[model samples]
Target: MDTMTYDYTEPVLSPKGQKMRDILADYITVVSHRLPDDVTKKLVELSKIEVDPLQRLIYDTMMENQMLAGKLKRPSCQDTGALQFFIKCGAKFPLLSELNAILKDAVYRATKQAPLRHNAVQTFDEFNTGMNIGDGIPSVFMQIVDDSADIEMYVYMAGGGCTLPGEAKVLMPGEGYEGVVRFVMDRMTSYGINACPPLLVGVGVGTSAETAALNSKLALMRRVDSVSPNKNAAKLEHLLEDGINHIGLGPQGFGGKASVMGVNVINTARHPSAIGVGVSTGCWSHRRGKINFDSDLNYDLPLNEGVEL
Candidate 1:
């Protein structure tokens, strides 16, 4: 019998490109171990309102887990999740052509350095790729911006538990916004507990299932405390937040005063006959990070504080 050995060498690149890749890899490692600033703050706020002994204990355990993850330099959760990047890049950015390859390489490096769990399994074939890189794994969705020379990215870990409750459907026009609320509430009642409350709920309204699904994910990228800018949408966010909190699923699904950190809604115009709504949830950890980079590779991580990568 022969044993196969794998090579984990970093990919060759221009000096600048190599630097950018290294930075991204380091950033991913940091993200794995640390909760974003907004998420941490929201969790603390929720902890204050919990009156149940068990729910309060759960919140305390969550905070301690975060502290130990950062202090010990390891992932906060066993499910590091499938990496996904949502990016808005300038058409004129220097590394636009190489960005895709750079991102893939960065994940590969992070998988080894962060020791991220192998979460990318090939569909139908049913085998974990082990590298966290498979066909379309470390999913990157990009939009090119005109007249700009910078890039903004949201890095998220869509864990199995959190992604389990995701759903989308098209409602009849006659159902109106009320229908949208009904769909979301149904999902929360049926599956929200599996996501690990207090969850950050993202709601998307659009013309079709795919659009709504994507927008729902984008909504997850927003800060937990953020509200939609559109007046009607903002009101819907508040309404959903109130309704979901009313579920009383509480922290870790034990009963308490609140069940969610916040609810975010993202909406766009839809066809006259149909309204599509999608839901995505982020667990209490809510490991979503935002980073921005200039054409020169100068970078800032707005969601993560005191992180230098």
Candidate 2:
């Protein structure tokens, strides 16, 4: 391939396009600062049932913290986490690559605009450059679909505080599916405290560790209280949820009626004799943002003209 350079001609953005980017940046900022809707609803419901004074106090503080963080336009947690953007791009869009770049720039910009803590770190050098960029960092997950011009993006703030506790294992062939459940229960009982509770437990079962891990991460991305379409899997989700909730780890690892907020199962086909399982939990403060845009640049959430981004 020969290198070719072209001079700039048309504007990269129209007035509406520029406004759309700013709006998106604002939405990401809001999601970063507030808990997801389902997680917040669970907290309110918990506060009502919470009999223990300390747990009630935590719930009240959490509810209050929501108000203060949004009003102040600051991140609810100091970690701020690595910015993970899940994007579904339209095939007809002319600016696919530009859109990705713009989003990444927005993440870096939001780190400063939201004044999110400097969480992205360079590996091997053991260094903190104070800016969020690192090699292969602030990753984006993208997929292109057919005949769709509208784009949907899910902005997730996957904090290290919650991710650090994730665990996965490969079970022996002799151990059946029961072995899988046992492994999950064991992992949750032992290390569930490491993740902030009440938690959103994402369980992935598949053919290998990497698949399992990825599936578990995907599981956490699902809406809380949404059950799997697969009957058996949905049942397992309900079972694991009840079991974990009974653990009494409660909010912030205290004791209460809501230990693990919800459990989601995302599984794939596994080898006949081998089973790989993974569990990743999101804390009650599941920081995720969403926005949709049409080809005309009309969009949603985290955007209002005159608002800070």
Candidate 3:
């Protein structure tokens, strides 16, 4: 193994960096109570747009859940789910060294302040680490996207009930993208009941199984109603959403209309002989938060942070 010792440089931060940490921690607390403003508005609109009376009732109840959760300062679901963060850090940010620590601290603080359930466990040892940190326990995925002076971070709470049925498949070149659709349809129909209904299904098409899996998770980081940036992908989004919703899994998979709130797809070029696909499904109770910060640590809150934590 090559070994070298170099003087480690510690990143210094403006006071804004410290303030940013508190803001982020507090953000987790607030969102844990109320659905993000954008999400609430979308849910309500979806409720109104839903043609089926059964689905409309589910939508109405979901809104009421949001209201009660916010008022009572309680988690909306008992599962609380596994926390994941998809972060894009800027290369020149003064507090790069501090970012990880900041996030870990924020998560810990949020757990206590929100009284978040203890979800982190020490594997093999079979122990709850309690602080929600273990080897990649919070499952943070970070990419240094550019030298620009801003960071975009998303906090996603993925529940086990929804992920229990996730899938990935490798198709032969002859199968093509049609294989992806087939796989999604199979999974949706086969195990749709395991996941909460009115899903926000995230699909990934990429070069490898791991890439596809990661992209599947990333696809869900997008807004529920937002279309993919790629035009072809956007078309696929509409097609998949319609196809799955047609199943009428309805709320809690109880059977009705509105099988999915949306379908979001993320794609990457693949090797000549392989087609990789994966899916990450989010229930209507999808709880994810987005916060953006400048190199100065000035946070641009997502439209969701409507209430004070």
Candidate 4:
């Protein structure tokens, strides 16, 4: 997805645009060092369910890591990860023309301010940019909203381990939705341990592999306690959660009672002949944040509490 290129002239930013950039940069910094409220809450819930001594210690260590990261104002993990911005912006928004430059600049500044690990490397050529900005680094996906002035953004740190098992495949018509479950379970059993279990699993079902893959990542933006709106998808989420936790990969994959925080499934109408399924996992850290803003640059951090930027 990062291979695609775009040609557009950059624009100068006004005061509002500049403010937006600073806000996003700081938001990224905070997200890197702090866990989102939902993720923190889920971890607390999981930590309480473990019985094994080693597994309980692992959970304790996870909490200590977060505490230290917060106190030191440093990234919670060494792999600060590839920055991904999923933006839903209004076409009529005042800074529309400068959004791209604003986001890129925010990423650049956040890299230095957060002291984020330089994770962006040129593909194939094998060279690190050392600044997390490259031809297509810090992936940005945007969707335009028609007649409104509100923009919603989701920032995600797609760490290597979390994304390693991400896969999408189109199943034959005969394979049915059961194929989707099998695909997720298969991937989880194979690599769930590596991703820091008590993982949040995202599954996508759609008409093609690419669509499913995108939807799968989007699924991770949902709250850990929320179920899919669609009845069938919600059922699948619960079933996948149960099946995964039953695997007993436990905290940090050391074997315990809980293997996952939750399972999220997002779907769209599929082509008559195909069922596409994709899987992505977020490690226990689950570093993702949501913020909403107006054209005036006024914003709210819904996933964060008692924080102002």
TM per candidate: 0.96, 0.87, 0.89, 0.95
lDDT score of residue 189 within candidate 1: 95
How badly does each model clash, as a count of residue pairs?
A: 0, 1, 1, 0
Residue 212 accuracy (lDDT) in model 4: 97
Model 4 C-alpha lDDT per residue in residues 1-309, reported as the tens digit of each score: 344433334346788888999999999999999999999999988888777789889989999999999999999999898999888988788887888789888888899999899888878767677778787777989899677888999999999998887999999989898889999999999988889778999999999999999999999998999999999999999999999999989988788998998999999899999999999999998899998998788899999998777
| Least well predicted 10-residue stretch by lDDT in candidate 4 | 1-10
Leading candidate by TM-score: 1
Tens digits of per-residue lDDT, candidate 1, 1-309, equal 543333345567788788888999998998898999999999999999877689889999999999999999899898999999999988888887778778889999999999899998878767677898887888999998676999999989899999999999999999999999999999999999999999899999999998899999999999999979999999999999999999999998998888888999999899999999999999998889888999888899999878886
In model 4, the clashing pairs are: none
How does each model score on lDDT? Answer: 0.90, 0.77, 0.78, 0.89
- What's the true lDDT of residue 100 in model 3? 71
Sort the candidates on lDDT, descending order.
1, 4, 3, 2
Residues 175-293 of candidate 3 have per-residue lDDT tens digits of 98778889899999998778887777889999888898888889888888888889998998998888997887878886765788789999999998998999989877788888888
Worst 10 residues of 1 by lDDT: 1-10
lDDT of model 3, residue 47: 74
Candidate no. 3 TM-score: 0.89
CA shift at 232, candidate 4, in angstroms?
Answer: 1.1
- Our model 2 lands, by Cα RMSD against the true structure, at 5.8
Native-to-model Cα distance after best TM-score fit, residue 112 in candidate 2, in Å: 1.2
Task: For residue 127, give model 2's deviation from the true position in Å.
Answer: 1.3
